[model samples]
Target: MSTVPETGTLALPPLDGLGQLLPRLSRRWPDRTALVTDERTLSFADLDRESSRVARALQDRSIHPGDRVALFSQNRWEWIVSYHAVLKAGAVVNPLNVMLTGEEVAYILADAGTKVLLASGERLDAVGDELRAVPSLEQVVSFDDCGHQVEQFSDLLAVDDDPGFTPFPVDPGSLACIAYTSGTTGRPKGAMQSQRSLVLNCAYAATMHGRTSDDVVITALPAPHVYGNVVINATFMVGGKVVLRKRFDAEDTLQCIVEHRATLLEGVPAMYAMLLASPALEDADLSSLTRSTVGGQTIAETVIDAWESRSGVPLIELWGMTELSGLGTTHAIHAPNVRGSIGVALPGVQVKVADTQDVTVECAPGEPGELLVRGPIVTMGYFNNTEATAETITPDGWLRTGDIATHDGQGHFFVVDRLKDMIITGGYNVYPAEIERVLIGHESVALVAVGREPDPVKGEVAHAYVVLAPGQQPDADALIAHCRQHMAAYKVPRAVHFVDTLPTTSSGKLIRRHLRSSATANA
Candidate 1:
């Protein structure tokens, strides 16, 4: 018997690196539509040629092997080209979240030692002088025409494509990406993933999801996210078309499924919630969707059942993190649907629940513990942060996923809670410490602690408990406005509670779990 149920006839292609993905697909399916957007559509051949031209431009700029090239833009065709172009140039990719503040972007760029920055003109202008502070940045390329000191993305694409161009040969074990994930320490850390890891993830995800040439997927997930990256690349790996959107609008998404005749619809739970809430959902034609996927956070079984029942499609729940490169566990399309569970591990990956108190001990079935993963899918470690790497990964190579999960005897894993205080708001990881750091910056804030608040749409939202300084009156609006300015919109607290004292241990350590009770008592 197969470790995973055989779902589809789509076989994994021989891929050593992501750089080879487009070139190989273009050769076999040159005329097949590979990417579709409202702005334009690209055949496999067109995508390959455009990426080659951009790769030559990057090489001309002296972007050598292992050099960091950052793409800081929303989902766009150019963003896709830049990704493959960076790989073809034998450079490491650093995809930045478009929602990041100028300060946050600067920190990541500087930390990754990004040499070339490819972004939208608006984002560059927003960062303005901050880009200059990063000494490692040698060139700034914008997708749109911008002010001085930046190269135009169109100009690079206009360059003559090297007929003999091919992806630079690099070891499969070599680092291919530095994905920055926000940590509990109030800063983002880069997860270094190898070329083999990424390529395998795409292959496995595509195979398990039953993606093939006949499939067309619609998604609005950010390209910078590992989940989004896999969804995009997995489609390309099997010669499928992707109807990529810059942002998620429930009505628009439902319409796209009908318009594109999409076979797969993929998104987080919040997206499904919004889709269910949309008035268009009742009249929208969803006959084409054979399967859909939800991940990035745990979703209620009710939401999954409601979606599957209404659309006549299966909602395949999967679980993963940035450290896993893409997916650690997901359901095979042909397998039994196990609602409220994240299915089983991908074929070659190993997953086990270790006792929270003693990681060396494996938890019994139905016993919740910290989910530990050991496999090639795991990231090498946090880039330039050995201390964090050691803390997260054991000497034997088991990656502590920081998720409290229980393994059913039958191979399914059910997530219970987060081992860390980090909140998942609309599928985005919101570190409480990061929020606390920003909220503490406010002049009126004396002591602040952030915690997860249950949200029907977002799964969980950040709720802050504040203990104001002496002589300061409660100003929830002002404090929230302050966070809005310093952090991304998603990371902003939905509500703030003014408390006389925050719940803490006798040693003065703030307890995040008790925050909801404190809010209730104060109210």
Candidate 2:
């Protein structure tokens, strides 16, 4: 049995499911502002009533416990309502990235066996009839009045109040959400997050950060992202107000902070960089910000210092993955903020750096190795992929995070690199295998390999090294445009290098680590 670490002084009320959050908060602070969007603001009471009505609508459509319901849309009040409503209706919520192309969405919906889809009108339009091909998808609900064959989300909120309606009972250990994350297998894997895992993560993360009802947080991270989910749900758990934006924009983020007098700002490292570059940031009133958080990818200390010097607030660095439901490690609000470290594991969680060759052997304090975690925050397993799950999680319950890190003598963890070839750009994960898979689809590309290139604004961008077919002329723009159709814009390579050959080992495996140096020499 794994030993559970002490949680210290944080106290949280027990809840069976995420559906209970709104009802409990409404009773505590019904009239308090629960959510604020560019379109409108909603109180806790309003949010509860609206979500309940949607849950009723979902039930009306025959959604039930364990049924998969996908929410494919940008950040909006309806998306938030739909998330809670799915849980209330006793269905599993699968929030999808808005940046995903229609084909990608179709694959996820089909893979998750989604029974219903709640999406924005624009998203519905973008996907067109692609989602209809998903045999498991029984219904489509549009957030706006789009001419798609779908139900109107507005109609769901128009129903009569069912005061006696109660959310369905669910075991805390049952799956609550299926978050898809790109993996090295050239496909996205669904990380099965249990109700216990997600709820406890929110409680622990919120407590560690000293989140309270008095806080007003401003975030522009997409609603589908695991980090974004934590930011939204954690705030809701404490009855704090969340200022949701459709997307991240430097100027708009600054404006929201000044306008709302936001007590906390949450975003990835790239977002902070953008804010620092924003002309409005110099004159922006950020006095209301008591502290801020930066995560998703490693950030430069200079950028952290710049933000703190200008805003006069602590920039807490955190590390997490979809497999963990949200945060795995972070600094407590009262703890010492180690400049480069990702901080210690959340209370009740155990983290260690293991030898790459032998995971059973722990690495020395200053030695770098694979980071492994064991806790309730870890995902039960990858959805419907037992092979992948077995490869990731040890028999002893340690989940291999695929991240290279080292532990200081004081318990702080510092990430050194990624053992996996996955690249993170602008807080979004981009797998090299996925990009290579897309590139290989091009007829002009005889052989292809993808590698990460250092970028200034975005942490890293994909760079493709290709060996063209006979009689094929290399046109970088053409290949890039082809990628745009098959993949999301962010996944497209920043540059394409045409080379005669790529470095490969005797075993015929393309050596990605040596791609940059080889490509430079060959180019």
Candidate 3:
């Protein structure tokens, strides 16, 4: 096992405001590369100066501290600059995913009570009119000129940097960012993260990953999401260079790795699956890569093994959520024996297992239960939704993570499944991840999702949707028989549907709701 850092017990500093850290880092690593988009690279010094200019421009427009600013764009250098610029002015940032519909975008803007919006010219048509309709939004700033309704981002950069602007007095508990969940449920609720929570999470990640100035981190995920934001900001916090990708493409990612000689790679499981299947990967030189990690969804061991076989680097599985600021548990790169586990609790974090009744359970090795987390890294609460906030955070400060997991005696945690994803069949509880993991081990299976199929007698039964590997043929009976060899009969999938591909979210999480709906529609 890799030696954990010797940070004796949780005597952390009263979280200093991010407003202070950004300026300090800017002064320390001014010449280092801070962000790299497809078309341009911004050094730390350039990012610092440009973001200061943006702060001044916003202030000149009467935007003040405690106001909410929205950023709706893909991962780009401008996005990074705008994020910090919003924070520099002590304003709250609301980053909306570009993949959202106009209505979804409108809901978030209104919910956050956003006063200003910063977006790219390419995405103007998608939400420009919708944002105009929001009464709470006082101003709209665009990366390019958009007639009268938008302020040009370049014009903002041309303004004189405000070196004399007084820093806002921000409390550690004040809202810093409102990141909306993917809305797998009904409407997405904004997860409120404070500057104290976000900065502490970044520091924890830096310690776990052993990040340094020499590491070049490639962020291929969208910045609007929590996973992408944490990785990008954490890289900067450690004085590492970040190579950004607007959209994830297997060939482009391989080329970026080779061209930039990237040392660290952060992506979700779908990105890895695509890269493993890409023809470009066969010829690409991936020798520069050393550290690679994945989160956002549960990853099958088969994918991990395939990636390690190809790249000579283990795919460290991480477990986190938007409320936790994107890191609660991560597999230690230095500890290869715990490759399938989500390593130990990150430095300054505590994790435990609780039964269905919310009682703390002393789980023996290999037993699974709901995972509960408490630490400086956890978010304070949801924005404005007091009911939801109270339900999520305990009175004692522990955040009930709705993930089902098991831990080995050695302290390594493996995600069994999601609490909501558990299917009840004949009164027997079944976790889809267990079935999915077993199915992926089959040679004929390329990708798979295990979900519940409605049954009149049982309410719901286990079902599998699988994509077959090219030229490999396997019938439903054979697949079921194969599963029987590794699992109990009740836990085996009752029905199987072969598909071309499983539906996944933009971030590469399998859209299980789609699967359920598809099964119902087909029936």
Candidate 4:
């Protein structure tokens, strides 16, 4: 009964070649500001020319069509340029998280079979050894001239543009990027996205958000993630200007929003919490912002009410995942009928609830079940992992989103929880099993269960319930130190509660849900 277009059958323009699209959009916008970082501003024309130059440089390095090039850097103008350059050169872009450990980096590079990596100088040290370890990576390009072994990114731009290099012809279904999602099992699997998937998602997001050329978007999320990628793509689709921040700093975010008069903002719930708690929230001139959107995790009604009261702007909630290309459901700002619900499915998307048997079920008003989504925006499949692909995507093409949700009679949906035991801390997914496996190896830990504990800013923080071996004891500080030595800093527990025994089922399997509930209640 929704007026929006039908699911999976929307007639979208064919997006066969991203290389051609960027140039054409540049011509249309011409002098319009396309990107603005802390240090520089690039107009559409500048982006076109520079990206072309970078594309030619990529070709000079033998990065040909279909090659996968990893981009490991923070949010910066260079990151944008690199993204366009890779696409223009007909290579797939694999953006790596700056926070990932060397082992994780090696796993991704080896898994994706990446040929080259473009990294910031500061991040080079973290992955230098890993890059060397992976024989498939032939070259390393650095954004800064650090007198290192890596090629300078600026030097690449100085290369003469190749006039004869024709843009490669590609089908809309050809792979565009392989975004890796942290797997519940072992290693992460790359969610293979097509050219159509990426382009259509951006267009749809822009349309849903009512973005215009006059809109100024401030992005605090890291570009390596799908959320940041979608925001950048959407902004460009509408010829909107973007203000990039390398990292999220509450005070700096306030200053940037005020100074740039940012009209739109995309952040996670933690960011909003920080901004609201900061002293600058009361004094900063945030009047320029007309829309503020939060996603990656849930937003409490209390936080929403407080933010709306202070900023005089409603906070829109979005529900999406990396596999969905960064948008599935959004709370439309202008919708009068469905106010609080994650607005009706975006154009060309279909949502249904399924029982444990995977059969579609109609929720009578407020009943919650597993949320299943099917659409063009959904990923083609997990790259190189047929088993995972089969598990996530049905034979009929519906993608099992693994989240629990309920819908009102009016068609508005509300997400309840995720089926996977994944923790979303500070907007980043942290799997407890991964951390528990590492913790149990510690000399002081006999049994350990990692779970989520409620936090004011992050919504949930990693909490560890540890039981030491008999006659052996490790303090909270020491156990935390041990975790930091074994895993990424964010994966380390923010708080460790010493316990005598961990709750387990009759079969001797650890019951993580009970541990999580106990930890939250006691916290």
Q: TM-scores, in order shown?
A: 0.81, 0.80, 0.91, 0.79
- Give per-residue CA lDDT, model 4, range 1-523, as digits (tens): 6563211222324557556656766656778788888789998878878888888888888999899999988888898888888888889988787766788888898889999899998888766776678878999899987767878998988987655555566677788888887544589899988887788777778877778777889887877787888888788776788888888888998898888899898887557755765777878888998888877755555556667788877788787887887888886567753444566787888987777464455566677677888988889888789999998898888888887677887768876656666788888867775677566656566567777778999888888897665567668888888888888887888988876556543112356667855555545
In model 1, state the lDDT of residue 253. Answer: 96
Superposing all C-alpha atoms, what RMSD in Å does each candidate have to the true structure? 10.8, 11.5, 4.6, 11.3
Segments in model 2 whose C-alpha atoms lie over 4 Å from true places: 1-12, 422-523
From the highest TM-score down, the ranking of the candidates is: 3, 1, 2, 4
Error of 1 at 240 (Å): 0.4
| Candidate of highest lDDT | 1
What C-alpha lDDT do the candidate models reach, one value each? 0.86, 0.85, 0.81, 0.77
Q: lDDT of candidate 2 vs native?
A: 0.85
Error of 1 at 176 (Å): 0.2
- Residues 144-200 of candidate 1 have per-residue lDDT tens digits of 887757789998998896779999988989999999985445799999999999998
Q: Is candidate 1 or candidate 3 better by TM-score?
A: 3
TM-score, model 4 to reference = 0.79
Lowest lDDT 10-residue stretch of candidate 4: 4-13
Candidate 2 residue-wise lDDT, 280-305, digit = tens: 88789999999999887666676678
Which ranges in model 3 have alpha carbons more than 4 Å from their true place?
1-15, 146-148, 163-169, 335-337, 360-364, 470-477, 516-523
Q: By summed lDDT, which 10 consecutive residues of candidate 1 come out lowest? A: 2-11
